[model samples]
Target chain A: MKLALVLPLLVPLLTAVACILAGASRVAQRALSVLGSGALLAAGLWLLRSVDAGGIQVVQLGNWPAPFGITLVADLFSAIMVAITGFVALCVAVFALANIDPARERFGFHPLYQLLLLGVCGAFLTGDLFNLFVWFEVMLMSSFVLLALGGERPQIEAAVKYLTLNFIASGLFLTALGILYGQFGTLNMADLAVKLRDQPSGVTLSSAMLLFVSFGIKAGVFPLFFWLPASYHTPPVAVSAIFAGLLTKVGVYALIRVFTLIFTADPATTHTLIVVVSVLTMITGVLGAAAQYEIRRVLSFHIISQIGYMTLGLGLFTTAAIAASIFYIVHHIVVKTNLFLIGGAIGHVRGTGELKQLGGLYRDYPWIGLLFLIPAMSLGGIPPLSGFFAKFALVKSALEIPSYWPVVAALAVGLLTLFSMTKIWAEAFWKAEPEGATGGTRGPVPLLMLVPIVAMALLTVAIGFFPGTLLDLATRAAGQLMNPNGYIEAVLGRTP
Target chain B: MPLQLAFSIVLLVRGHNEPGGGFIGGLVAACGIALHGIAFGIPAARRLLRVPPPMLIGTGLLIAALSGLPGLFQGQPFLTGLWGGSVPTLLAGQLKFGTPLLFDVGVYLVVAGIAVHLIFTMAEDQ
Candidate 1:
């Protein structure tokens, strides 16, 4: 169990090192990259099983006890998260084999990719507040490099905006950490959960707001999502797919984890704030998506809108709501990533992502259209697909809370989401090629890229068809999240 | 530059107990190497190191990650510091050999490699 706790982190760190050392041959680096992510996936699965069999697993670094030494904990939520990350990383790594330009690959893409994975897994596994910050920086640094890897004019421009906003967020996060430590004198999350309960509400609310704003920026919630759409489309498709799939979700995860564990003192205030932000986030994201003409930009806006649904679950603060949020997250990660990959494939064949420049994919490559349809419909909440169940649960939870506005906004956003998905379908797939457009003589989408897209699409169908298993797992994770005693007990060895 | 390198080694050895640690030691050593490169040019400094910066970084990371495995093998938590008998050193009094020192050495190499790499890139770009 102890070993399992660290495996997710260790595997990636070692893989990244190996990738760096394998610099002499691009083929070797690619093979190592695939093997490493596969190993991370295996380790993630092992950790999930152990955490499932024997509840939350905790490990103390350097043999120091809890609240003093760094801690790594794997609950069902974190385990599932790590497992899904490995799944996505493996998929993207494979896709990059064919999709990434040789110039980019030669310039250290594999090692940076592994380093990004290392940072992500670290963020999900670390139990210390300050440790989480360090992991976020690691994740950010690699992602920033990945974004600006080729240093094109547009990429450099986007990266600058990304860096400036993220640095501000990081500053706020550090300030919150300083304030929390000043009040509670502990950087351990479990310890803070215990200590924060007795302190006056002033520091608690202030730090909570600070954390919300900081994580909100990361999650791309309302009024702070400008950077996402501006930057996500500038990078290579593989980079965009991973970013769309993982980066903002980490922000949502942090919001859920911190709010559920550390700031339950005044949910009436904090959660209410979350509720407001989520509703606005939903409305704005859908509106933003509706206005986009580019396939990736449209998808990027939807990421923000969907973030609203997950945070809504957090704001409702119920087992059912949180479970729905978890289900939504799991479903969204796969479906969204698959959509991005499909978008990349579309761009690959057509040579442009602009909807006006694209058309008749359904005629030329019927399979690509079929591939795009599954995830696109899934994103739009079409029935029997994963999105429908996820949205249904979230909406049901909201109705039960008797919060009518978020439900109204979610349903309305659902409609808008469907509209934009169809817009892409209509403009990019249904319409005949524009006059004088050079649509001829391009090769079929590479099998390497098609393989991951198909795999993720099938996974989406599987989840849609068999919601019970994932929903049950999500319920258990939510139960663990709602009751902090288990986490506190596991980490501190005493129930708070 | 050679004296500075020796001083960096001293700092690294004394770091486990005192204020001087791998990070500071690495910076000092990198500064010395940067000075050499600045004065004598890139080729001479490359000869002086005898290995590329990226390789140094990879080696350092591998060493650091490997250092943590002993604890896991021993049935303790990962990264648990396990110590061996003290080593009698000339400059620093009896230095205890442990995974921490090995980990520090790894950090030292990585930090130094990164600093020198950045300096080299900046110099080359001009």
Candidate 2:
């Protein structure tokens, strides 16, 4: 079991090293990335099965006993996250193979991509708080390069803003960790959870708020999310897809982990703040999405708005609410990445990601348009799709809490989401081709790229129809989180 | 160029135990790289480094992230430092060695890499 946890982290690191040594060899880089990602995907699936048969599994490092050593715990929730990350990474790699310029093969893109995967996997699997921050830095540093890869004016401008914002966030994370260490004298998350349980007074609450603000900035909640939209669309499409799919969600996952396990006692104060901010996040994000005329920019804003839904679930703080949030997160990652990949393909066929310049794509690329529609509708929460089920579950949970404002906000956000989706559809795919369009020739949409998008679309539909499996997985995960004594006990041995 | 080197040295010396560390130090070093570009040429610097600036940034990040792995097994949070004997290797045993040293090294590489890359790219544009 420990092997399962370590394998995902090690494979990427090893493959990255291998890619570097292989140097300028496209075949070597591709083979190494595929094999590495494939093995991780297999390991993630096997871990999922293991969890379904039993319960959460903990992997304590270096034969160290729990509480003192760093631990990797994979419940159903983490397994799902790992699997999703592996799948998305695999697709991004394939897309890069087809789309990345061969001349630029030696530029270290492949190595960084693999390293980024290691960071993402590590973040999902680790059962400690400080380790989580390290992984966040790992992910951020790689993303900084990817963002500035081409170093165009726009990319540079975007990267500077991105770097500055995240630097501040990392600084906040370090300060929070310092406070947590000072208060509890430990940084192992499981141990912190134990120490937090018996803290004399309001220390836990204040520390928890500090942790929340730190993670919230990464998660892109309303106030701190400005960096996301300002920079996300400036990167190349493949880079955008990976960032769109994985980065912010890692923050959200961290929030869910901490709030449920380490800080479950105070809902009225913490959860209400989450709820209020979530509503504002949703409204502002979708409105931002609606206001965008550029295709990628619209998608970027929607990322923030959809994150609001996921946070809403955590804020509602129920078994059902979390399950729905998990479901929505998975659904969003697939749909959002696919939409970006489609946007990439559109950018390839046409010259720009601006919707005004990207008309009549459906006529030239009917298959691409059809593929785009599935994720778009799913994103809009249309029925009989994964998005619908996720939203339905969350909205139902909100109503159950009988929380009128959140329920209304969730419903309204869904409508705005649909409006934004249609806006992209109308301008990019439906509108007439502009006159004097050169209709420049482009290579056919690469199969490697197409396969991942189609696979994701199929998964979206399949999950919607047979949501029972994912739903059960999410429920068990939420359960493990709610009663995280098992997590703490597994990481650190029982007292006395 | 001499002044830039002096700045880099100043940054590296003040980095430890201060707000400035390898990251800031490396950025300062990059300012030196930029000076080299101004004094010489973009192609000359590129030939000297043998990789683009972005790749350097990528490699720096990799090193920095990898620096945290030891903490995972030490029962410390990721990136948490481990220290052993502080006996000096030189200077009459006045100096100490620690994991923070390794972290500083990682920071050094990252800072230097990013600095060089930024200078190279900016020079290319010019």
Candidate 3:
């Protein structure tokens, strides 16, 4: 059990080292990358199974006791997250075999990629707030290099914006950490939950707001999400897919963790604020997507809109709502990642992602078109697909609370989301090739790129077909979030 | 230059019980290397460090990560320190060895390599 908890962090660190040592041989590094991701997935699944069967798993590092030593805990929510991260990392690693150019590969892409996974797994598994900050920095450093690896003009421009904004977000997070430590004298999340409940609401609210904004920026929420769309499309498609699938979701996970576990004191105020931000986030994100002509830019905007849906469950602050949020997160991660990979496939085939420049995908490569349609329709919340269930659960929970405005906004945003999806389908797939266009293949589409896209699309279909098992797991995770005593107990070991 | 390097090693070793640690010690060593470069030339400094900066960084990270495996083997959590009996040294009294010390040594190499790499890059650009 203890070994399982550390595997997610240790495996990636070791893989990165091996990649670095074998840096001269591109083939060796590539093999090691795939092997590492495979190990990560196995470890994640093992940890998830253990946590599911035996309850929350905790390991205190270096023999230090709780609240002092670095604590690594895997609740069902975190285990699911870590497992999904491993899954996505594997897919992206495979896709990069074709998507990344030789020059970038030689620029240490494999080692940096492994480091990024290490940081992400560390973020998900860590139990301390300050430790979370450290992991965030690790993730930030690797991703910054990944974004700028090619050093193209557009990439450099996007990297600057990304770097500046994320640093500010980190600054806000650090300030919040300082305030919390001053107030409670502890940075262990479980310890804070116990100490915070007795404190005056006013003091906690300030730190909560700071943390919300910090995580809010990372999650791409309203009034602070400008960085996402401006920069996401500039990187290589494989990088974009992993970033889309995992990066923002970590912020959402932190929001869910802190809001549920640590800041349950004044939900009436904090959650209400979240509801307002969520609705605004949804409306604005969908509107932005509707206006975009580029495939990736459209998908990036949708990331923000979908984040609103995930946080809405938190704002609703009910057991069912949180479960729906978890369900939504799982479904969105798979669907959105598939969409980006399909976009990459489209780019590979057509030599461009501009909808106007793209055409005849449905006519020439119907297999690719079919792959694209699954995730596209799923993202639009078409019935019987994964999105439908996720949206249905969230809407049901919201209406149960009788929160009518958010419901009205949510349904409207759903329609807008469909409009954008159809727009991409029509412009990129259904239309004929424009005059003076090459009208045929850019080059042979690499099977490596197509494999992960198909796999993720199949995952979308599977989740849509078998929502019951995942929903049950999500409900159990929500139960843990609603009552964090189990988490607190596991970390602090039966605190009086 | 040799005295400076020796002093930095002292800082790194005593860091477990004193104010000095890997980061400061590495910075001090990097400074010594920089001073030598300023006086004796960049090639001389580079020759003084036998390996490339990146190799140092990678090796340091490898050592740090491997240092944790002993505890895993001992059925403790990852990074749990396992101390060995003290070994008598000629200069210092009995010096104890443990995973923490190994971890610090790894950090020292990494920090020093990074500092030197930055300095070399900046100086070479001129």
lDDT of 1 by residue, A16-87 (tens): 899888877989999999999999999999999999999999999988999899999989999999999999
- Stretches off by above 4 angstroms in model 2 are A198-200, A439-443, B1-126
Ranking by TM-score: 1, 3, 2
List, residue by residue over B18-104, the lDDT tens digit for candidate 2: 556667777776777676777788777677667765556546555655666776666554555666565433212223345565666
Candidate of highest TM-score = 1
How high is each candidate's TM-score? 0.98, 0.82, 0.97
Candidates 1 and 2 compared: the better one by lDDT is 1
Most DockQ-accurate candidate: 1
Candidate 3 per-residue lDDT, tens place, A366-419, comes to 888888889888888897889989999999999998888988998899999999
The alpha-carbon deviation from the true structure for residue B35 of candidate 3, after best TM-score superposition, in angstroms, is 3.9
Q: What is the lDDT of residue A376 in candidate 1?
A: 92
True contacts kept of each: 0.92, 0.00, 0.69
**TM-score evaluated only on chain B, model 1:** 0.95
TM-score of 3: 0.97
Error of 2 at A462 (Å): 1.1
Candidate ranking under lDDT, highest first, comes to: 1, 3, 2
